[model samples]
Target: MAVIAPAGDRITDVAGITVGHHHRIDATARVADPESPGAGWATGTTVIRIDAPSAVCAVDVRGGGPGTRETDLLDPSNTVQTAHALVLTGGSAYGLAAADGVMAGLEALGVGLPMDDQGHVVPIVPAAVIFDLPVGSWDRRPDAGFGRRALAAATVDVAVGSVGAGAGARAGALKGGIGTAGTRIADGPAAGVQVGAVMVANPVGSVIDPATGLPWAATALDLDTYGLTPPDAGDVARLGDLVAKQTVLNTTIGVVATDAALDPSSTRRVAMAGHDGLARAIVPAHSPLDGDTIFAVATGTVHPPQPDTVPPGMNRDVGLLAEVCRVAANVVQRAIVGAVLAAEPVAGIPTYGDVLASAIR
Candidate 1:
């Protein structure tokens, strides 16, 4: 059996990839106070920048209400085969403006496709937004400046929890936030390949199973490493109360990246497989009210495995691409759970950590 192990516990573990985040949190005193300045400022922006000039990219939008920009250009048949950056943001449609700032930033850095010899380069930045207006004042969502700051702050050390697009996010009845995880292929045909996922888990459906007050995928995935156990009746009751009040529509957005060399078409397959992880972690995923989107990028730093046997149909290693997809799905699932565990409460909503801790009477 090929061995795969967690690496760096962040999306940045995928070489040539860096992440940045900028957000505003609503004040306790001014919670939902529309009259206050920046009172409803619990939204933010997250940027996933490709550090190697450009990289093959693709997207999978499973939710019914996605707010996106430049996604069509990423199609395998499109003229643009690579992307400079990807934006996962709050602010719904309005937040799409953030990508503009990223484009300008990349332009300043001389990163993008060369359009003319006169130093004119057009950066291909694709973006998606999660509806987080209800978290704060509707008008206080992310803007171009948010994107700019996040891009400027890009680094390999990713910070999970209540930051970036997940600052005001929710998972079912619990608070939601950012999370990341990485995997390294070892002792396999694709040895040294790196796969990682970073997700903002703000879903309309529950991340936890109501019956157990624990994530639905935890048992099957052996997520005891997160220190989560079946909750007592008190914990279940508390979760029930929160679910009743969590009526705001929201979505989950993320980026899954790999170091393997893959074409746009293969990258798209990776993106599609990532959603399986989302479905595993969040109950009733891809709901009509949710705008779940996952962007997949291939840095192409490592060559994908080639069939070692002649007459390729007989080789077991022919399933190398399938292995990558499976790893992508696994990392995504772990990232969602990481988000749930790392989250902090917003506006009076309690985090899963809080509920679990309070139950320990």
Candidate 2:
């Protein structure tokens, strides 16, 4: 007797959850809406926080050489446990500066790690990013100051599309690049719960259909509607040759937050489940060169208990934790897909529609 929400069921509000974000547009990238002027991130950071402990749990990368930090600590053995606070920024690995701002912000609000008798905070921040300055300039890298600014501007009603780490972002062939959405699961059946997501567009692949699991950008399009071009197909071996000539480092990362009461073990479960959501959106996901990561936090307000919360052989109930994590994983993946679809054409960058057009033609 298991009940799981099907895909595309806008469940932005599951528990008393909310979001806030800030985006900066780069003056460098070619924007489709030349007339559309927005804050340029050339360097900026995004901070997502839940009022209560956004529960804690997560899964690691599916690829080698994936860029990430504090992921290995999810094992429960590490001394690096954390409350709810995830920082997703713009500068590949270098953007880690954003976390400092987030930590400082959280510390100011007294929202993270138990304080020592001395009043010191053990901040555990997990971060991710994408390579933006591929056009020959570090003009799009996020900055630490931006992370601090994002925290100062954090809220429950979070925004999406060109906000946060997504400001200077782009996805597929569409002008699309940053997107955000939320759904409420609190009411008659699932009362007192909420699930929400904030995603950045910097994937090394495409987001597509749920049934076929194929990316729309990778398929043919019927342009009569918009004539979108599919994302440029990279040459396999021939592509490798070209890549060797031109090294392009890319990644897409974000955080998944929930109000479900999850322990360290359960947190890990939620983290794993969130990945399902990622796979649902991106084709050939978790590939090498992709620094995909997820952070699951529990506010401990709601108790969605797991009989065996700890993982086998471990000093925790990882089993039950993993189950809910799986559900969360599904939600996170959907969020990513939503971000891509929601992404609009920007600075001359074709929208997902444009990519579809090229493929169809």
In terms of lDDT, the best-performing candidate is 1
What is the lDDT for 171 in model 2?
48
Candidate 2 C-alpha lDDT tens digits along 1-361? 1112233342335453334455555555553233443333343467765455445546455544455666776676666555455677776677777787777777776666766776666666677766655422355565666777887776544455555676556543333244444444434322445555566756665565322223433334322322334334431233224223332335667666666665666566566666677776675577786776766666666554335544567734344344445556555665665565555544444444343333333
- The worst-scoring run of ten residues by lDDT in candidate 2 lies at 1-10
Candidate 1 lDDT tens digits, 1-361? 1012235667898878888998888565133433443345788899998976447899999999899998898899988888888999988899999988899888999888998889889988999988877777778878888998999989887888878988878788788888898888874657778899999998999888877777785663355556665667887888888788776557988999998878788889999999999999898999898999999998888875566564745544335557788889988988898888888777666788788764322
Per-residue lDDT of 178 in model 1? 85
Candidate 1 deviant stretches above 4 angstroms? 1-7, 29-39, 310-318, 358-361
Candidate 2 TM-score to native: 0.71
- Summed backbone clashes in each candidate are 1, 88
RMSD of 1: 4.5
